[model samples]
Target: MTHIQIGCNLSYTVTQTTSFLFNIAAARTLQQTIGEETLQLNPAIHFETFTLGTEGIQVYRIVAEPCELQLQYHAQVELYPDRYDTAEIIETDFQHLPYEVLPYLNPSRYCESDRLAHFATRLFGNIPHGYSRVTEICDWINANLDYQAGSSGESTSACDVLIQRVGVCRDYAHLAIALCRALCIPARYISGYALGLQPPDFHGFFEAYLGSRWYLFDATRMAPVEGFVRIGIGRDAADASFATIIGTAALTTMSVWAQ
Candidate 1:
């Protein structure tokens, strides 16, 4: 087993200064098992509450606030532990919890679930009921999608990327999730920080389940390697958003940097 230190820094460059509602600041770690808590070192900088969810995972949620919105998160995990490697980790069944995720997984008219299924079938065909199929899906996504930033944003959907054939990490993750769900595979979106050598220090990723075990996959980074740090998980970006507010704010200029 190898122990590693992972850190994620996220910042938002606002075009203007305005009051913004922020959430997802709450940070929690998940252990190898659902019942245990993964060790977390540094606590959140500015947060409203820190609590454990029903699944026994740590969570951080922020409330309405105003600022330049520069946030940094750091955590350490034993990567590729003797008990857990990429193959071993991803080969297990995903923990099924559709009851907890269905409401959030519902698609809108613009991105209907049925439409997504048809689109994904063009590439993945009928979703295979095995790990090999899942791996194939991942490999296919990596092979087909080009990893470029600023191609798409928060509202972009899988179909949009399918047509354009270009997108950012979030777009790739959304595309992957849509494809998995279309196959009746329960999948979820993950929002976290990825260690990069450049700015926008954090990136997005996704996870899917085959049966009971949840396997982590990063369509943005392609795979979790040395510098990946997790922040949050939900059905999609809508559920995993870092900040949201009912009121309006003019975002003037925002900047994010990480290394």
Candidate 2:
């Protein structure tokens, strides 16, 4: 088991009454256990913590008026991820896929799998099936795309990253997910804290449904897959965004760490 300590501090300037929905807490799963954690808000505002969907994703909701909102979160997690032999992990047939895994095969806000179908087939059609094929997809992305920190924006989609060939960690995952889905593979986005990430911060990775389960992959190749601590899982980045503000607010500072 790997023990990791993760946390983050965020400062926001609220101009008006704002509702902040934060998905920064470590997810509750049998694979990982939270040892000690704390969530604090300056001024001691009222906030509620709740779970979302079947992933046991934890979300923090806070309503703050015009003020300097400071949020702090810290946690110690023990990861016990499932281990599988790559060579033996075969792809699951569409007709046999579970109901919960079907949605990941379709297109979403950031992943335009429908439009990239032909391109994906042409690029990956000749590759052997199963885990190796997915690895090649990630390898292709890591080799071709330039990992520039601010090369893309929130509005950027998988197609945009494909054309520009430049993106950050999330963009890499978005493109990989789109391509995998286009190839009839069930893939999904994952938001988490990654150890060994340069200039450490929250990281974006993905999982491809293979065999009878999902296996994690990182197209960015920026961090060790075993060191990942999942926070949220969804069809795309939209569903797993770290922060969503309902009113006017500007993020002034953010510091994240995972060790």
Candidate 3:
């Protein structure tokens, strides 16, 4: 069993009535045990809590007036990663894949698998299929793309990242997910607090459905996959954004930690 402690703090200034949705809680799963979770609000505004998908991606919604809005969250949990043998993880044909995995093989807002089909095939088609093919895709991405902070915008997509060859962690993940899907490997985006990530902060990664289970892969390779604590999962970043403000709000301070 692995124990982890994580915390998130944010300070915002609101001009008028603003609504905010937060997805900064540690996901509770059979593999992870959540303990001592806490949330603090400066003005103590009432909030409703809900979860998305079967994994219970926690979301908290609240509305407050013009004031210094401060929110802090802390949690302790344990993560247990499943181990699989490489030789046993054969690529399952489309006919055998589960219904949920089918959607990930299609295109999405940030991961345009359809548009990159030609390119992904021409470059990676010759490689042996299964985990080897997926690894090649990740290797190609790491070698070609330059990891530059603040290089990509919210509107950037997988094709854009391929052309520019530079992006943050999310961009790397988007490109990887697109290529995996083009090869008929079901893949999805994931967000988490990387335990050993330097310049510590929330991180983005991808998982490919291999054999009969989903395996994690990080294109950035900045943190050990086993150390990642999942926060959200979706086709791309659009579904996993940490925060969404409906009205006017200026973020004055933000901090994240994993220990």
Candidate 4:
């Protein structure tokens, strides 16, 4: 077992904060299981209501009164009883899972001749068979893709990142997931905090399932290390955004800090 700590500092400035709505908060760890509610030690700066979304993703919604707003928040996560050997158990649990549990695995969404399959075939060409293939793919993504914060925008597609050769963790995960789903493998997008070494900060990571077990693989970090905290899981990044506001708000300045 291992113990890890994670922290996040998010800050933004709004042009006109008319009822500022935000969704920035830590997610309960998977160790706590689905549908379980637990208090976090580092609370959010503003009061927010928790909402559950598909695939165990949590949403924190906060509404603030109108004003020129500069908002900042920090979160810390301590992961305990960290057993990395859950791969076998995860595989076994899903071996006999009903189709209802994984409707996204339906091949109808990705026809046999679809681009997803083509991409997977290309990626799988050099990889040896079995779990090693998944590992190789994850490692390849981590090594090939550079971690840049604003390289890609919200509207960027998985294919776009593949061509650009640069992206954030979410882009890498999306590309991997697209290929995995095309190959009839079950994959999901994960959003959460990764504890940084210097001063501490929150980043994102992802996990994928091969055969009977779920393996945590961070395309961003590439290697299994300490301080990876999970916030939510979903089909893709669109399903795992920290906050999505409808109206336009110009972010003038932002800053983040952690201890």
Which one wins on lDDT?
Answer: 2
Model 1, residue 156: distance off in Å is 1.4
Runs in model 2 deviating more than 4 A are none
> TM per model?
0.68, 0.98, 0.97, 0.72
Model 3 reaches what TM-score against the true structure? 0.97
Model 1 misplacement above 4 A:
1-26, 32-47, 52-98, 101-111, 126-128, 197-200, 222-227, 246-259
Q: Residue 184 error for model 2, in Å?
A: 0.7
Tens digits of per-residue lDDT, candidate 3, 171-201, equal: 9999999999999999999998998888888
Clashing pairs in 4: 91-212, 91-213, 194-203
Q: What C-alpha RMSD separates each model from the true structure?
A: 6.0, 0.8, 1.0, 5.3
Candidates by TM-score, descending order: 2, 3, 4, 1
- For candidate 2, what's the RMSD? 0.8
- Measured by TM-score, the strongest candidate is 2
Write the residue-wise lDDT of candidate 1 on 1-259 in tens digits.
3343444344544344334344333244443212222222222334444544553234444433444455544445443412234343332323455466554345542234567776667767654555555667777777788777787866688788877888877777777777777766667776654545355544667776744556667765543434454556666777656556444444344343323
Cα error, residue 47 of model 2, in Å, equals 0.8
Provide the overall lDDT of each model, using Cα atoms, as 2-decimal numbers.
Answer: 0.55, 0.95, 0.91, 0.55
